[model samples]
Target: MAVKVAIFDWDGTLVDSVEHIADSLHQAATELGYPALERAAYRNIIGLGIEEALESLYPGITRADMQAMREGYGRYFFTKATTPREVFAGVTEMLADLRGAGLGRAVATGKSRRGLDKALVSSGLGVHFDITRCADETRSKPDPAMLGEILRFYRIEPDEAVMIGDTIYDMEMAQRIGMPAIGVEWGVHDQDTLAAFGPKAIVDSMADLRRALELL
Candidate 1:
């Protein structure tokens, strides 16, 4: 089916912020007098919202501790963020092409509304996406609510939209919602893992992603 709407995941899909995310979490933990999270452990929770990520990482965490982590991590992430973030090569052109081709662009991400909003403005890509759904604004991924909302908002059926993302959460979310999804290898999870969720295709680069979306 041809894609009328293109939904993307922010962190790993459009912007290469894996290191930033991991490092910021580490810094926040240190500042909050908690032990630093292992690199792999931090990497594993990239697609979840801050609260969910904290809960998943620190199983018995109290609400107060979670709030502290959130504030600390957010402070470090925002202050250190160079603004607009570094986008993958060809992303600008890809978004421009998608817009020019008359496709509606949106974001369904694990980032909080504030985080995603700051990124959109900083990265200057806000104009490309007509609508965006964040984890804070809806249920987290693998649940399908975000995609369902996006589909409903645009009056587009699940089959008419293509979810382009980089994680298992993304694939499972779209799959459960009856939407076709394509994975990007350049994100947080490996190709094998993303493929495990049965994406329509998995592309390794932004160029490949653009090509795949074109085919869709």
Candidate 2:
């Protein structure tokens, strides 16, 4: 059966914004008097929402501190980041191909609407997704709310769509919803870690992902 919708996990999957994410996180940590999170620590929290990331980085941080950190990170990221984030190679082409195939493409992400919009716009891929859901509106990932919303929006069964992401949160969400998932290796999560989530397959490159999607 043909897949009707392709739901993507944004940050690491479509755009290589992990470095920006981590840099902002580090700046936030410094502002809050917490130690900066290294890339590995940042990687583990990438798929989850900002709250989860802050909680993981500062295990006992107060609510006030969390709010401060979140705001601080956004300020730094939206301002200090020099180069605009670029979409991964072949992502635009692949999305165009999927759209041409009469497939609906949506982004289900942990980023808030503003953050998601900024990333997509900066990457010049905002025109690709037909629908988008961010952490601000839905329950965070591994909860299935966003993916469920995507399925509902497209009016398609879980089997009619595939969730593609680079994190365990993405795979876990797909699994809980009984949806097939594809993991990408070039993203934040390690392939082994992503494999543990029981994705339908893991592709090493976006080109490989395009092939995996069978977009001819």
Candidate 3:
């Protein structure tokens, strides 16, 4: 079936926030008195929930320590939030094309509910999405709950929706639901990493994505 719903990821997919994200993780690690984590350590967990990501990086930390790290990351991020980053080229056009094709637009993100909400308005794409599910509100990526909820909300089956994202977590989550996944190269994970999760296609640019999804 043709894709009637296009579910997107926020951070590295639509917008470019890797620098800020890395800085926040570093600050959080520092605040928690953990030695600064290597870039690769934190970068790989970008698609997970705050608790899950921190736990993955620190593996042996206590609940309180995780909470402290989470809080510190949020604080550090907000403090550095000066100018908002623009979405990838043709992103707005992509959304418009999807809308014009009568395809439903949604977001399944690793960010917290508040973080996703803030990004929606700040990025000026709030009006484009018909639904959004955040990490705090559901099981994080690589789990199918978020995609399942979106499909249920729209009363559509997995095949009718396409997951568009930049990370392996996003691809894995879609695979769990038997939905098609399209990976983007500009995100946290490289093409090979995302490909191992079995995406339908991995596009190098927004233009290529348009062709892959037939958004045009």
Candidate 4:
């Protein structure tokens, strides 16, 4: 089936912000008297929203404290941390190509509205997305509300859309909604795990991604 819309996951898929994310979480954890998370564990839990991620990483932490930590981390990352978020190579070209082909593009992420805005501004790829869905405005990944809403808003059928992500949540969201998915290898999750989701295709590099979408 042809793909008319391309929905992307922001964090691990388009931009490599895992280090910034880990640093922010580590600072938050330290301030909250909790241990820092390992990079791999952090990557695995990132698709969940802040509250869920906190609960998963720091079991027994109070909800209020977790909320406070999230606030503190967001403040630090947005204001203090100017860490350069590295966009995958060829992303700009790929987006341009997709747009030239008349494909729609949007983002569905677990990042809060404020956080998503900050990252997009920092990454300089904000203009590439026609619509951006944040956790604050919609249900988080695995819930499929984010994807469903984007599809509805654009008047695109699920079969006419494809989700491109680096994590399982992206795959699950697409699968649950009956949309095609293309798992990117450079993102957070293991390529093997992404392949297990039976993606219509899995891209090893951004160039490969261009070819995959072209074929679609």
For model 2, name the residue pairs that clash: none
TM-score ranking, best first: 1, 3, 2, 4
Q: Between which residue pairs do clashes occur in model 3?
A: none
Number of the candidate with higher lDDT, 2 or 4: 2
| lDDT ranking of the models | 1, 3, 2, 4
Put down candidate 4 lDDT per residue, 1-216, tens digits, no spaces: 278899999888887776677778888888877876677777787777888788888888897898899988886677643234377777877887778778898999988888888777777787788998987787878778999899988898898999999888889989999999999888788878998778989888888888887777
- lDDT for position 34 in model 1: 78
- Candidate 1 — what's its lDDT? 0.87
Q: How would you encode candidate 3's per-residue C-alpha lDDT over 1-216 as one tens digit per residue? A: 288899999988988887788889998888768988788777889989888898888889999888888888888877743234467777888898788878899999999998888878877888889999999998988898999999999999999999999899999999989999999999899988989988888999888898898841
Which parts of model 1 have CA positions greater than 4 angstroms off?
A: 82-85
Q: What is the lDDT for 101 in model 1?
A: 87
lDDT, each prediction: 0.87, 0.84, 0.87, 0.82
1-216 per-residue lDDT for model 2 (tens digits):
278888999888888788888888887888768876567887678878888767877888999999998899889889843223367777888889888878899999998788887777667787888999988888888899998888888898898899999989999999999998899988888789889878888999877787778841
Pairs that clash in candidate 1: 84-122, 84-123
Per-residue lDDT tens digits for candidate 1, residues 1-216, read 287999999998899898899988888878877787779888888988888888888888898988988998898889855355488888888889888988898999999898888888888888899899999989988788999899988999999999988889899999998899999998889999999888999999777787788788
